[model samples]
Target: MDRNALLVGGAVGVVVVAAVTAVLVPGVLADPTDEGPIRPGPVDVADVSIAAGPATGETVTLGIETRIDHRGNPTQNVSVLVRAIDAESGLLATTQRVDVGNISRDGETTAATNLTVPREGGYDIEVALYREAERVDQAKRSVSGVSAIKPPYLQSTTSFTDTEALPPVSYSIEDAGEDRTTLDLTATLTNTGDEPAEDLSVTFVLRQAESNIVASRTTVDAGTISAGRTDSVDATATVPSGYNYYIDAVLMRDGVVIDTARGAANLNPTRTISVNQTTEDVELRVEDFEDDDDRTPEDYESERTRTESSAPGFGVVVALVALLATALVARRWRQ
Candidate 1:
C-alpha cells in the first residue's frame, strides 16, 4: 500500500476502536445484571429547614431542598418528602410530599409545606427523595421558634370536673379497624345532676403519649340529657400509624369543658405512618401524617445562637491565618 493511504487506514481503524470503547467502557466497569428496564440514579436531599408560617402559634412551613445530578439518564415522576418530627416525643407531627412532574438531568428545587407544631419546641425536619416506594436520599435538620398556646379552658389546671353533682361521662372505642386507617369512638354523658345538662358538646381527642399534640379531634352533640338519663354520641376519626393512641372524651357545656374520660385502643400494626402522597396543582395538604411529639424550642434556639455567635470568630481566625501567611512570605523573600 502507499505510505499515505496506509496511515489514513490506520487512523480510521483507531477511530472505530475509540468509538466502540466509548460505548462499552461504562458497561464493562458497571455491575453485571439481567436485562431489564434502565434505572435512573438517586436524587439527594441537599438541605432541610423550618421557618415560621403565615399562621401564628404552632404552625410553621417546612422547607426541603433537593438536588438531582447524574451523568447518565435523568429521573422523572419522582417524589420529594418532608416530615416534621418532635425531638422530645420522637413522634412525627406532619409530612408532605411533592411529586416532581419531571426532574431534568441536573437541577435543584425547593418544596415547602405548612404543618402545625404539636407544641412550642424543637423539631427534626427530615427531607427525602423517593422513586416509587424506594427511598433515594434523605437529610435531617433541627429547627426552633415554635410557640405553644394554652387552651383557655384548662390554663391553670391539668383537668377539671364540676363538684355540683356533675354529669358522669363514659368513653368507649366502639369499633376500630386497622385496614381502613380509622377508628370509631362513642361517648355517653349521664346527667347525674338534678337539673338537665343542656347544650352539651362531647369531644374526642386522640392522644399520643409524652406530647401535648392531639392526633385526631372530633366533636359530637349531646344536646340535652335529662336528670338520671344518659345520651350517647358517636365519633369517627382518622388515625395515623407509628404510635400508641388513646382517646380522651371531654364533656363541654356552654363553651366550658366539664367532665373528661380516657379510653385506650390499639390500632397501628406497623407502628409507623406512611407520609408519602401524590402531588397537586396547588398546595399539597397531607392528612394522615401529623406531629404530636415533644421537643425543646429553647435548645434549638440556643444551638442556632451559638452557631451565629461563633461565625465572626471563625472569620477572624481565617483572616489572621491569611495575615500570618503573608508575613511569613515577606520574611522569607527578604531572607
Candidate 2:
C-alpha cells in the first residue's frame, strides 16, 4: 500500500474504534457538568405532634408538627404534607403542605402545617415527608373531643361568683307595706379569665314560690368587669306582700345568658322559703298580659285568667313556653 493510503486507512480504523468505545460505554466521555442519577437521602418520620387551635364557627384549626430524622445524607426540596381525616367515616376533612427547604446536616429537622377541620368529631392526622415528588416517610396521630373547643367570641372571661361563703345573689328589704313590698337585689360577679369582661348585664327575675309566677323582672347594666376582680350589680323589684319569692339572677352578655344564681326572700311571715327548696311541677308560667307595668297583683291575676279562658289551645302555648323557659334555664345554669 501507498503511504497516503496507509495513513488514511489507519486514521479511519482509529475513528471506528473510538465510535465503538463511545457506544459500548455510555456517559464515559459525557459532559462533566451533567447531573447523575438522583438517589434520595434516607429520611424517616421521627415524631408527629398535633395541637388544637382556636375554633371559629363550625371549623377548628389543627397545628401539625412533624419531626424528620435524616441519618444517611443531606436532603433537598423537602416538604411535609398534613391531612386530617374523620376517624369515624375515614373521610378526608382537610389537608395542608409546608416546604422546609434543604436539610444539610445529619440530624433532626422540623416541618409544620395547619389544617382546619370541622369541630364535630374525632380525627386521624396523617403526616407525610417528601423529597421533591417522592415520598420517603409517613406518620399518623389521633385526636378526640374536638367539639369541646370554644370560639373566642363564645368564650366568657367573667362568671357569677358561686361559693358557699360568698353568695352570688343577695337581697334585702327596702320597704314594707300592707299590699306591696320593695326589695333590693345585688348580684356579685367575678372574672376568672385573663381578659376583661365588657358590655355585660344582669337580669333579676322574681318568681312566686308557690305558683312559680314571675312577679317582677329588671335588668341592670354591669359594664366592664376587670380581670381577676369581683364586681356587683344592684337592682330593685317590688312585689305583692305576704308571699315568698325566688330571685333568679341571670348574667348576660350581648343579650345571651351566660350564668345564673338563685336566692330566696321570705316576705310571708307564715311560710318560710329556702333557695334550695323545690316548687310545684307546673308548666312555665309566662304572663300573657301585654303590659304588666305598674299593674297590681290582682289586676295581673285577673288578666291572666281572662286571657287563658279566651285563648284556645292554651295548653300548647304553655308547653311551648315551658320548652323555651327550660332552654333558657339550661343555658343559664351551664358552666
Model 2: lDDT of residue 197:
83
Candidate number of the best TM-score = 2
Model 2: per-residue Cα lDDT over 1-335, one tens digit each: 79999999999999999899989998768787878775657888999988889798799998888989986667789988888899999999988889988887888888877888999999999888898899888988999999877777667878888888878999998999877789999999999878888999999999888787788899999988888999999999988777788999998888777778999998877678789885434333344312456678999799799998868656778879889999999999994
C-alpha lDDT of all candidate models, in order: 0.62, 0.85
In model 2, which regions exceed 4 Å deviation? 1-39, 51-54, 76-78, 86-92, 99-102, 119-123, 130-136, 142-156, 170-183, 193-198, 206-215, 223-227, 239-248, 253-335
Q: For model 2, what is the error of residue 279's alpha carbon versus the real structure, in angstroms, after optimal superposition? A: 6.8
lDDT of 1: 0.62
**Decoy 1 TM-score against native:** 0.32
Off-target runs (Cα >4 Å) in candidate 1 are: 1-36, 63-71, 148-335
TM-score of each: 0.32, 0.58
